[model samples]
Target: MSLVVTTNVAGMNSQRALSIADRQLTTSLERLSSGSRINRAADDASNLAISEGLRAQIGGFRVALRNTQDGISVLQTAEGALTETQGILHRMRDLSVQAANAGSLDDDARGNLQSEIGQLRNELDRIAGTTSFNGRKLLDGGYRTVFHVGADAGHTIAVDLGRGTSAAALGVDGIDVTGPGRYGPGAVTLSTAAAPGTAAVLTIAAAGGSAGFSGGTGGVSAYTDLDGTISVGGRSFDLASVRYDTAADTDGNGTRDAADLLAQLNRAAIVALGLTSPPFSSPTPGTLAFAVAEPLPGHTGTAGAPLSASAADLARSTPTFTAAGGASRALTAIDAAIERISTVRGDLGAVQNRLEHNIAKLGVALDNTAASDSRIRDTDMATEMTAFTRTQILSQAGTAMLAQAHAAPQGVLKLLV
Candidate 1:
């Protein structure tokens, strides 16, 4: 090869090789120091994008796990409150059973029991009203929420508490185990004789103004002029100048007696006014029982707003255990309330379990996603070190070669001398 001093191409080529090797060495060092292969988009653009996506997924999974935990906490709070409510309901049941022993317990004893029941009922209402999580009421019948349990959109769980645990909601608001009988004197007793169904006894007391019906008045003697109208299911029936004995002999037995009075009350016209067929019955001597046909209006106990009985009215009626058999009925109501509370607690427990599973799932997803990101974006220390060693050796060798190329022009000068 002919040698030239003006431009030593060999030196230029050696310098270019050295520059490439030095760049490789620098890159290897950066990878080793940072512990990342794709520090910049230029390192591997597509893989960098993929790694970023995986990182985002991992972040979402972490947040979802936290959300599931929070959801579980909320459910636990609600369930804990319900457990207390169940205890109260059980106690109320015991009180009702105790009050039911009318032969042994006197008015004073029964009255004390009723007082306890009232307090317990109030407590139930308070629990329903006050039970909350994160400032959201859980037992007021309006609790409905969603928990995000997954990294992807629409991966959620819904929680809804169907109804409130209040006394009114549980049909124990009007529990009164105190009275002369289960229906109470002068009270309108509503029941279904043919089948077991909803029943209510509305006590219209003389102390509330008009002279109410006498529990001792048997047959037609029980009939009296009700000064006001009795409303049932929003329909009103005028009782003015109407006497049970004077009404038509509806029993078809000819004589107008208690049965006739019941027949008149169950007349098609009255039935059309929301009174069920054969609605009235005398469960005992001188006692008037009116089977509720539909929901009754609020029992104001005033002379003008006498309401006919229905299951809905019973739910709103406060129970007085002071009357005979009143305690037995209250016991039944307490049992029902207990069952309701149990159902609510069960639902809450189920939700808690589901949330636990959700947390596990989120953890697994986060782990897998993080691993995937590591594969795409993280450098292997062993592999990177090996590459660094090779690049370092190449850099040194290229530098030496560049020096040789630069000295080659001196050989031409020696020939000239």
Candidate 2:
């Protein structure tokens, strides 16, 4: 195994050493320059996978934070509009209180007060219609709602006061009584209980209580405890008494009472009962009674105006105010609108808070993931420098030994000479 060249064995050894040194130097140079241990998948596949995953998470976090900011912006805009709307409602309420006092206001004064109410209603409608943030209307009253009074199995009447001035006033027409049985053919049963044979008579004929039927020619002389005159369809009838019989069978079960008949009658009346004026007012400590009146002019204008509205127009006899008398109703509607705004704001606040919390959590998560990625891919400069210096020295030594090893092979040439 010995060679003639004394340094041949050393030459091969030095060459192998040089190759190892060159490889180490190249690796150190790459790490130092690139600041990464995993320059390629072959360098470290596991670390490459982990590093890429961390990068994707960082990108998603940044995008999510941006989205949270956008949501907050929209919520803030809606909140601003709601705050202004609340002020408007408060102003309307104050005006209502001013108008409610009768002692200080004459008919003219009350009429003027109603004019102001009309203006306020217009303004509220304008605000509701126009107030929008980012092209979305928040105070427009369609958001959250509650139904009362007129509820049925299939259809329910939801009073939407937010339809601006259209819903401002509701008019109940006078009962157009053409003849008997305007609603339908049969013994019209008015009862105090839910019985079919309830012996309740029409005490006060509502002017617009029935459709296609004429008001019956009867007066307080027909009944008792009624002392008011009501007009319907151009006809007037005096009020009579309201009697609740326990034997009235409104349910058709042979037994009738005040509660059942009243329910049935009111339910039936609600659907088609007419009066160009307000329906019969329930007398104190008495049951429900229909106001009877003879036929008159086909139309007497709007129905039972609210007491506040009627009171406003007493002096004129035919009080006509351009502004409608649905301010109370409007107040209710505006309140509902405000509640809707608040509900949306509350939801937005919750979302914003959650986003903030998520952002904080994401920050922590990003930090941990970055740390893990760094451990796998980041260069250790000190370690790299140490290896680099060692490799440099070994390469230099190998070159010197190569020269000496070549001289030994030259000695073989000398021997041949």
Candidate 3:
């Protein structure tokens, strides 16, 4: 309040006030344009940090929703395939029941019924093995699926539907080829029978045989009545084409019998019989014996249950209606298979329902989280505009005052004059 010629302190005070008002006005304009309360760390550092965290969570939730949808799709694929398997199993069961009526279903009719039943069983195996989702095998029991449902560890949904229900897994017993094999009935005795890997000659013959070979002719052609192709363990081999010699008899002196024929059956024949060579047994003169073993190449695993077949293909097998009650056992197996398939379908349906609910929950969570984040980070347009208008008035008033203060020095000039 002093009239001094040396300094105009009033003008300097007005200039400082004007600068403060101008800076505030610019800040209000920026807030209005960006529609954000915290444009930078300086605006509201705490709230900006908090909003960032919330945004990350919202993103995670969206990803989890997508994962859930994908899981549902995969389950749907498996469910459809299992449904078809159920229908096939039901048809097989019906056929088995009909075939069981021994008097009504004669040998020929039963044979036809069994043929259809076998086809159905094979179809079941095919569906179980080949059903897939997004190139991942679903029904093969080899896939173990996991989906992350939350942003943190241990927040996942796991689905483990192990190897699907194949016909073999359903306990559908395969056909018994040639009943029980043994070293008898024209048993050809080995000169020196080695355990498993030993190769020796069939030198002697005991009577009671299907085919007799006379050493007089050097080689009596081949074994009779054993020329047809026999199927074993889902493989077929022609026994007629395979040549059997009593240790390469040079002068027709080697005594060849039915055992020699069985031992020297073709590789294909051996595989078809489902028995590995060198069956452990001392060969009688005319016969040799081997226990009937279903070539389960990889069914019974090295540790208890293996999955690989020697050929990596499940035996394409069917039951033959040869026994008196063959159909009865088949009917039981079909019933069990049906029950198992039903269980699988039920599980899929339940999971689908659960996932639908999970999606709904995710949607709710996303909406709420966005709302929370908006409250923390978004500007109130009405509030910002009001502040901007006020700052505009203050800046205009400050400019006028600053000019008046600067002119206040003119009062000193008037005193000088």
Q: Quantify all predictions' global Cα lDDT against the true fold.
A: 0.70, 0.47, 0.61
TM-score-sorted candidate list, best first: 1, 3, 2
Candidate order, lDDT descending: 1, 3, 2
Number of the top TM-score candidate: 1
- Report the lDDT tens digits of candidate 3 across residue range 33-147: 8888888999998988899999999999899899889989888888888888888878877777776666665567867876787687788778878888878888777878787
lDDT of 2 by residue, 1-417 (tens): 545754478789878888888888898899999999889898889879989987776666566555555555555665565566556556655655565454575667656755665665566566656765467564565433322111123221122223221113111011111122122211122223223332223332223342111122332111123333333223344333233222144566533333443444444333332322334333322233233232112223233211111211211132111112233333444456456545655765665576566567657766786788788889989988898899899889988887887776775676677
Deviating ranges (above 4 Å) for candidate 2: 1-9, 105-294, 297-336, 413-417
TM-score for each candidate, following the candidate numbering: 0.70, 0.55, 0.62
Model 1 C-alpha lDDT per residue in residues 1-417, reported as the tens digit of each score = 877899999999999999999999999999999999999999999998888888889888988988999998898888889889999999898888787787898899889999999999999999999998888899999998899988889999999887788898997887777754533223432333313453333332232243344321333244454433344333345543355546665657655554555456556325333322344444443344444334235433443333445544544443332222466657777888888888878888888999998888778878888998998889999999999999999999999999999898998878898
Clashes of 1: 20
For each candidate, C-alpha RMSD in Å? 11.9, 14.3, 14.0
1 versus 2: better lDDT goes to = 1
Worst 10 residues of 1 by lDDT: 199-208
